[model samples]
Target: MAPTLPFRDINVHASPSHYAFSSPSSPSSPTLVVDRPSGDLRLHDGKLLGTQRVSSIAGILGIIKLRLDKYIIVITKAQPMGRLKGHMIYKVIATEFLPLRERPLHDPDEDTYLSLIKTLLKTGPMYFSYSFDLTNSFQRQAESDTSAPLWKRTDDRFFWNRFVQTDLIDFRTGGGNAHGFRQSLGQQPGMDPYILPVMFGMLEIKNTSIKGKPLTFVLITRRSRHRAGTRYFSRGIDEYGHVSNFNETEQAIILNDDSSSGLGGFAGDLGYQNGKIGGAAAQERQVLSYVQTRGSVPVYWAEVNTLKYTPTLQIRGVESATQAAKLHFDEQIRLYGDNWLVNLVNQKGRERRVKEAYEQLVKSLVSAPTEDTEADRVTREKFHIVEPERQKHELDRLHYIYFDFHNETKGLRWHRAQLLMEQLREPILQHGYFRGVDPPAVATESKSGTDRRLW
Candidate 1:
């Protein structure tokens, strides 16, 4: 029940001496803003006014503006897995009661406030922050019971942490029959425990549209057969019409696996569609469709596995074309080099042939044509070199999200990797033996004498 401090980024590094977070295996603190008291204007007779005071409004508005400026607008009504409902409203609201924190101060007036001013000058004018010690609840409780050392003159130096109810987003399952168990590695309790999650890591993203409106996009993640219980991810619109946000505290307590097919039952067709997983094929689809459907909201993709381990699945939306194209080329090239250019007795043999063809392509600077079976015996005199297909300059946006795998939501996405493996294993290569150098360097044809690469 202790308060949480400014959260540390999951990827950040810290040495023991400077690090603040003490424990992790322990559950995270509830992140809601609770215990809010409506501020009232007191009458001369000590009567309470019906509304909050002007100062309270200013304080809340100040914090809201600060948050808006500091963080891009993510208008969240759906709490992520590790968060509580209403966590956002309460966090900004709680900052109101504390007077110790202030906006930029004007010139200090007195010698008495000089030390405070000097301390601010030496350290920082920013708000002082802290988190509750989660390791020792009793120690924190005992410490809260005691008064501060006779050091500070103002109660404003202290801050109280906040929390919300333990509500979670339930990602409903697609019926009792999921493809997870069928395509899984055969084992009751088999496979490395770590790699097991990889089975459930597959996810997809799709374009969404309402009848007359422009195409709106959403990122969807799936959670199936959770161990703790069911999670309901059914859609509902509150008084406000956001499709995914659920505001009614009165939601029926059915698990994500609610059997009653009522208010919240199951995920519809979006569950079983074909999309790239983490391999090379996935990269191609993700980048291609993303660029194809430019200028729309980006939704992160996720899903749960019904496999040996039902770890949560996640695939983030791509941001830029340059990045996307780069990632796309890198992954596809890997597949082409290692999987496509081969011929052998078995699957392994096919893989070896692909590797050989890839080496030939890079070394001889030419691709073997798939038109005939005698491509392997092709001589240097018969080689034909061609430039990569060029997309328009604007299409280079594909290079953004497609460029870097690190920028991809889930780390080490291999969506197309497996498919590329299969493709490279195929015993086909493109080349030309019946040729002449009398042809033009660039092929072109028109009404006049338009002939170019005919060379």
Candidate 2:
């Protein structure tokens, strides 16, 4: 196959354009990377990696950093339905993981790690726009220390693991863009020339009717670009312990006075919420509540086969399932504090074991008396099952394998979103509401280009 130069046709309008390599779409062949001015194409080994036709390509999703190397992530557009208006209408059907270089560490765990990461890439449910810069925008919010130009980056904490992974990946993958980012580290950086990831579902509630105080709460969830396939197709855990689905979920609350609170230019204030709109005194008084959670493929073992109308199921064992549940709850406590309400949905059939295991684990944590009376009391009061009376307090689910992006995941998310809304509804309706108000700006800045609205 003939290797192609990435972004060769587009005018980067710079000499000595920095280049990075993507993993090969297939195991047998190497793909190409480019130097803008010279128009030279080569592989990580300094061999010339070639490219195919532009019509055959969709776009690059920005380079990803792996443990030892960097890979150019490509989204290929497929035109199975044929062409229109002299153009081939394409959809991003597949991703190509082209490696930039050979693995450096020869550890026994390296192979397993690579396979797990690949599984994440192949399985991740990603839809790309030939126009939007999903990679750079995500990195800026998640990895970049400096802010972007058109859209302001949200709080780094809003996309916690997403930022962690990208930063580590950038460090491990070596330098492509970071080389340039380093020079402007201390100095005030220019606005980023990238677009934020597209958000599918957004909730905006205007709370003016109930009380004299008028406030708005906006919630947006940016789906992880790294998504796996539907829940039914993928199976088992890879070496790294990541299961089928992995993605970041961001939740933000926007509040403003009635006068300045129209969607027309309201997002401009989001930048102020980054806790950096003014000096130290101003930052300290800001009151913004942004929280992020994650949903991934279950760590337990299960397989699905299309041959049968319904896939055969297996529980694998109780030990691993228990451990996975323990680790998950532990992390939640560590991040969000010990106050949690464990909700175990009972069901018949295979899920019975999984649900039972989770319930038992929660019971163990709450029932086990510790030496510290205060600690024991907190555990007992804060953790409990979701009974019919306390439905308002429930906010999250403990599903081992949440089929994110599928119909099943959607229903689950909607259910949770409703629960959250219910928690807020009763209080707002009862008293209109009164509290300390120092809400942060909820603006979004992006690189100057064809802009898209995520609201």
Indicate which candidate wins on lDDT. Answer: 2
Query: Which regions of candidate 1 fall more than 4 Å away from where they truly are?
Result: 1-52, 55-98, 101-216, 220-263, 267-455
Give me the candidate number with maximum TM-score.
Answer: 2
* lDDT of model 1 at position 354: 26
List per-prediction Cα lDDT, in the order shown: 0.19, 0.34
**For model 1, what is the alpha-carbon lDDT of residue 209?**
31
- Whole-model lDDT, model 2: 0.34
- For candidate 1, what is the TM-score? 0.16
**TM-scores for all predictions:** 0.16, 0.40
* Candidate 1 lDDT tens digits, 1-455: 22222222211112211111111222242111111121110102121223332221111111111211111011111112211111111111111112222335543443234444234323321111112111111111222322221111112101111100000000001111122232222221111110101001112222333453222122211121111121323221112212122110100111111112121111111212354222321111110011001111112222345554544533332222224323323433321221121222121222323223322332222232223211122121111222223433322211110111122213556573343234323222221111111011222121111111000
